[model samples]
Target: MSGAIEFWFDFSSSYAYFAAKRIDALGARVGRPVLWRPFMLGTAFRETGARGLSTTPLKKDYARHDWARLARAGGFDFRLPEGHPLIALAATRAFYAIDEDSPAEAARFARAVFERYYIEGLDTTSARAMGDFAAGLGLDGDRIAAACESAAIKDKARVMSESAVARGVFGSPWFFVDDEPFWGHDRMAMMEDWIRTGGW
Candidate 1:
């Protein structure tokens, strides 16, 4: 069987948010399924000793401007929440829990969470917020929120992050088309080409 396009990303990453908006379509065009894998960016930052764009001095401002430009160019709504780069642990865990039963639903839930944070300018860092997002999608909000605290879900999330780092994923919106890796939202076009031509 053909390998799926693995989309490893942080739920709090704006670049990942932009990528999330288009990745499914990219997968469709290439005749591959998208495996939406949500991991903790803080774990990656800790391992790589890198700071978030919002925390970095000069890059923060530039990133904000870039995000605005990308949003305008892509024709999507985007606004930095009050507490930018909020912890996405709860949401990530909830995604894994839901994914255990339904991957498509989990992807749907992840998109909703991204929209709530980036487009609606709301908080999705808390379990309650995650539950609300899940409930909005006709899921069991309480079960999902409760799963955030489960040992199994926590371990699953931790392992996923560790696996991502081990696989050389140092940034958000990282993609792996088979064994080849692509980083950043801007690399999506290059990734598409690589997939189309079966790599150069």
Candidate 2:
């Protein structure tokens, strides 16, 4: 990949969670750097008139079975954390804080929040949980916690959500090779092929 691939994700989306763990390998194969951008799905949905997965019985049912299939196919241990819907705006903004510190590690930190709420049945909105999650990533716990509460980061998240709207993104795990957007993990292979053949 001569340029870069943008991966826009939301922490609470099951598909985004799955893609994050595997897209890096796909990028490596194509010789491209993955530019991870975390955004709020709720904002995107509000603007685009899309609904959350949990609210859609058909999609939610499909996801329920699909997640099990994915776990087996990908050889990753899978467990649905809880039934509570996650509000990811704060956590998504927190990603920008840890991003420059370490992109790979930052992704892990964001994923930790995902796992905590989605897989471990933990209440991530708790101040204590956020601090503990930050500490686990070797980040300054207090600083990260404070940053999450900052108006600046909150604004930053709003910007990212608007940016996604501008980019015509309506969902999570959206990948872009330049302006060409790929919307699902299944398209990851095509992303790799595009990179190897020199970006389209």
Candidate 3:
């Protein structure tokens, strides 16, 4: 099989939400599988001393406008959740826990979580929210919520975030085509080109 496209993203990232909607199809078009890896963007911020797009000064306003434009162009509904830049630790942990058992379900759960926050304007930052979403998908929500608090899952999430930083990932929607790193949702076109041409 061809190498999977490593899609590193944060649940709280609006741009990452956009990438999630399109990435899987991109992978299908190229005969490559998409590996959705959710990591804590907070860890990256701590390491890089960077603020989130929603929290940054002038950029935050620009981002809001850009997000709307992107939504219109993509024909997807999008709205910032009540509290922008939510703490996604619970969601990330739950994702890894579920992923261990079923990758496809985990990906579906991830999309649902993103929709809950970005589309429905709901809070998805808590374990309860994660459970609710999981239950809606016919998974064992209670068990998933309990797993989020497990030391093993917590450690797994932390290690994944650290690994992302180690791999030079500093932003949501980061992608790796082989060893080359591409950051930001806007880079998806370039990523497609790279995949089609086998790099320049």
Candidate 4:
């Protein structure tokens, strides 16, 4: 009970998208609400000295086939976002830049970012797209630009990424229950089982 499950994710994570659809139900079974911690997996890689799946030719090939198979099986839509190595720095900042009174709005904006990249082929790094995305999220577009420029938000993003590494997370879609880290969207069943048995 003392340790909450942290969901460390980024916008471009395809598997993260898959997990997001299912994690809430798993958390509900455990009487725990998953804390959504958005962090840049790219940042985590840079800091932790871990290379992305693009490091090896074989790995990249496998990823393509895996995603295709998984996407088809799950009936999930597949579209590559406009920006692969996107700088989500500003977007992350915008969420933290908003005032406490606007938390719900901020969350909506964050969710939009995810949907933009994972579900839609929008370039999230584009200012115009971000402005529109913010507007769609029930936030004032003017305020979105200001939030994107906040130093505090950038710092928070960095801290969140570091925390993900500290928690032994080396990639996207990391889930934790108590001190146990579950890496990958496929491991959700394991987490669900653990939750059902009350610490099995």
Candidate 5:
């Protein structure tokens, strides 16, 4: 409660979508503010010489089943899109554009984007889709679209991705309670414990 929980996520990550749905309420319960950071997983992948789980053959198959199992356990609906592991640069950029001005508002926008991609199976990578989502949040859709292409916004996103890598973020759905780092959606309970007890 004394410090913020830094949440690092990639829009293309299904686990990140899972965490996004619940992080806010968890933070509120603990009297802590969550800092939602949307960064490109591709950048970290390049640094680590790794591909996404959905890109691996056997691992990909297991991931689908595991995601579904987790959804069932949590009592939420989850359907894998026709193509998994979507390219989400547009959605990430759009969130950053809104985040520069309002972090809370950006979090709301991120939830909408997550639902669009993970639930409704909509395209989160297209400028049009991102603009439409932003507009639905009462933001200026055209301006949001334009900002995605702006050098400043692009640089901001680049810096955030690099910073995340430099800070040892190797995967999506990572959280930092101060300098302590936790990874994966499955680690949320531990994260909440860390927040409540200040880590053991």
Candidate 6:
């Protein structure tokens, strides 16, 4: 591979959680590093006029059912969270703050957040939840909790999200291998094929 795979994801996206669990191994197998990009989806939705699949009438019903099926197939233990979509702003800001100094730790924190939200059904939208997760990673919980509300961290998260939107990303679990774009966990096979065959 000539370049790393840019994995753009939102913490509230279950599909992104599935991808996050596997992207690193997939990238390693193909001799490429996965660049984890965490972004807030609220701005992306506003920019693209896109709504969540689970919020769209008939699609919402199917999505709830499909989420469980996909989770089972992917071997990811999932429970429908009490609050389906929690505001991801604080958690996202925390991610960017950690990512700025340590990408690896950021990845770990991201996965932990996903697991906490989906499997454990915790309300990870809270700054306290974010701080708890960060503390587990040996980070300063109070500092990170404070950072989540800081102007600098907030702006960083916004810029990262807006930059993704500017790059034509309007969905969760979106990936770019160099200039090639792929979307959704369902497209993982295609992405792997593209990596191996260098695209058609």
Candidate 3 local lDDT, 110-182, one digit each (tens) = 9888888898876667787788789888999999999998999999999999999999999998999887899
Candidate 5 lowest-lDDT run of ten = 76-85
Q: For candidate 5, what is the total of clashing residue pairs?
A: 0
Model 2 TM-score, 2 decimals:
0.89
Q: What is the lDDT of every predicted structure here?
A: 0.91, 0.76, 0.91, 0.69, 0.87, 0.85
Candidate 3 to truth, TM: 0.97
Better of 2 and 3 by lDDT: 3
Flag regions of model 6 displaced more than 4 Å: none
RMSD versus native structure for model 1: 1.1
Cα displacement (angstroms), candidate 6, residue 12, comes to 0.9
Model 2: lDDT equals: 0.76
Better structure of 3 and 6 per lDDT: 3
Model 2 Cα lDDT, one tens digit per residue, 20-126: 77877877876678888888888788887889877887998888799889978988766776554667655776677677577777767766776666557655554
| Model 5 ranges off by over 4 Å | none
- After superposition on all C-alphas, the RMSD of every candidate to the true structure, in Å, is 1.1, 2.2, 1.1, 2.6, 1.5, 1.6
Residue pairs with backbone atoms closer than 3 Å in model 4 (clashes)? none
Q: In terms of TM-score, which candidate is stronger, 1 or 2?
A: 1
Question: What is residue 148's positional error in candidate 2, in angstroms?
Answer: 0.7
Pairs of residues at least 3 apart in sequence or in different chains that clash in candidate 2:
81-118, 81-119
Candidate 6 Cα lDDT to native? 0.85
